[model samples]
Target: MPVEIKLFMCRTDNFGALLHDRDSGETAIIDAPEEAPIIDAITHSGWTPSMLLITHHHGDHVEANLALKRRYKLRIIGPEAERDKIPGIDDTVEEGSVIPFGEERIEVISTPGHTAGHVCYHLPKAKAAFTADTLFAMGCGRLFERPAPVMFESLKKLAALPADTAIYCGHEYTLSNARFALTVDPDNAALQARAAKVEALRAEGKPTLPTTIGEELATNPFLRWADPAIRKHLGMEKASDVEVFAEIRRRKDNF
Candidate 1:
């Protein structure tokens, strides 16, 4: 009765995923990044998706939407705020919307920073989340729509997830993100260990993802806005959490 999530490469660094329920043999494609790779992944796994869950309207994430929908007759669900931008959306969901994925419940958490309509799909039963570009490994998406304050609040939502929750992102930027993290949290042994691990994984051409909330909490600088040590390191010890978060994001943007 477990859900099996598989990640595959799509359009350079983008990651496309297939979430298959073992109990029902039903599959849901988490973002349609590209058509061919998706098809190849499907062919190999022998699991054709019946639904497509989109987070945003970014072209790289939804470019294969029409193609996949036409091919699989998928029921597409996307953010209500950006329905106009996402093609083939059969249903619109926002924060607090919970939909069924076979026997599993997929909860939507609106994270509108990377884009105004960006969201993350969280499966409570599986303790897994699909954060396309909202929350990445060690880093987050660029603020193309909202400002730092909004993005900081959005990240806090993810930070509140149970520490054991597993996180899957849309890209493999952990190596670079980890490198940037060390510059800010140089004394963080946890981060130092993770960065070394990421380097080794990338060297072997292996994926360095599926970072847990616990691991990220201990290492990701973006999620450490409330830490006093980090505040002191950034010379923002007297600043509010939002201000500190904005400063960290500002540094990352330039890093």
Candidate 2:
């Protein structure tokens, strides 16, 4: 059975996703950003919810977990570290955890920098991954809890996935991320092309997301820590990969 996904806007920039198994009609929501939009998307798709996959306990991500659970019978799953913070959480997952969504398998990847227990879900069969806030189109989440090294390792995990993997992240920050990426990698033709595309998309009020790992690998400065151009631009040519990544992140923070 093929799994179909629908992406929509919720709570300004937050992305609300609906994952449906076409054959079994089993539906799961990646996160409950808002109750109304989620209900609307569900009703529009005519797919009933069976599960709620939470990335973290951030209010913007899990604001409607309990509300949605109240409206439908859902198996709410979240990170074990913040299980108490996620309302209506029925189950918890950690690194290396695997769960089934109809016939497909959902691989839980622990990415703990955005929050101590933040995670991303990978569906290898579908070649799709819900990165949430941990990884973005051309940037990464801020190190709110863990240090730069921890977040860098989390990103490397995602980077280690197949290059063709389609990345569905949590927010619509691609345009800004693209602009920041240009500052560090001005000579990259791929980055230049991607930045122009992102600018055009935002001009048209379109979503600048669903970027692939290959695309991110080629353009995202945060992911391009080893790119000689970036290393030279940052004047950290002799620094470790982790140190170079931290400087890029620090610059982005002030950018």
Candidate 3:
């Protein structure tokens, strides 16, 4: 059975993706931002959600879990560490657990620091990853609930993914993120090119997501903090990886 992955942008730029197997009619909602959008999509597709994959306990990410669970009696799968925060979680999955979705299996990756219980979902057979607020197209999420170092470490784990893995992040922060990326590595030719591209897309009101790991590695300054050139451009000399990451993030927050 072929995988049917349809991504939907919902609720002020948040992503609510639907993954299904056409053959089996097995469907999963990855981080629903609102009940209306998820319910609307499920109704349009004529498929009831079997599983609700919660990436984090953030309201924008998991707010609709209970509503959907009560509506469809769906199984809510989320990180074990965030059980206190997440509503209606039926299964607490760890990093190595593989959850079934029709013929596809999603491998859980424990990515803390975006929130203490943040986790990204990876379907190896599909080469797709749902990264919620941990890493963005040309940036990383702010260290809201945890320290910068912890977020940096979490990013490193995602960055190590196969270059071709398709990244479906939680928000549409790319255009603004690209603008900030330019400040950190102003002379980067690839970033210059990407910023122009992002600008054109936003001007046309298009979504700029599903970025590849390779594209991010090449253009994202947060991921490039360890690069000698980016560190030099940021006016840091002989800094540790974590320090460099912190400085870049601090600059971004102020940028």
Best by lDDT: 2
Q: For model 1, how does the per-residue alpha-carbon lDDT over 47-99 read when each residue is reduced to its tens digit?
A: 98899999999999999999999999989999999999998999999999998
lDDT of 2 by residue, 66-151 (tens): 89998998999999999989999999999999988878999999999989999899999999999999899999998988999999
TM-score of each predicted structure versus truth: 0.98, 0.99, 0.96
Residue range with the least summed lDDT across 10 consecutive positions in model 3:
1-10
Error of 3 at 248 (Å): 0.7
Candidates in order have lDDT scores of 0.92, 0.93, 0.88
Q: Over 4 Å off in model 3, which ranges? A: none
RMSD of 2: 0.8
Instruction: Give the root-mean-square deviation of each candidate in angstroms.
Output: 0.9, 0.8, 1.3
**Candidate 2 accuracy as lDDT:** 0.93
Worst 10 residues of 2 by lDDT: 207-216
Those runs of model 1 whose alpha carbons end farther than 4 Å from true positions after fitting are: none
Ranking by lDDT: 2, 1, 3
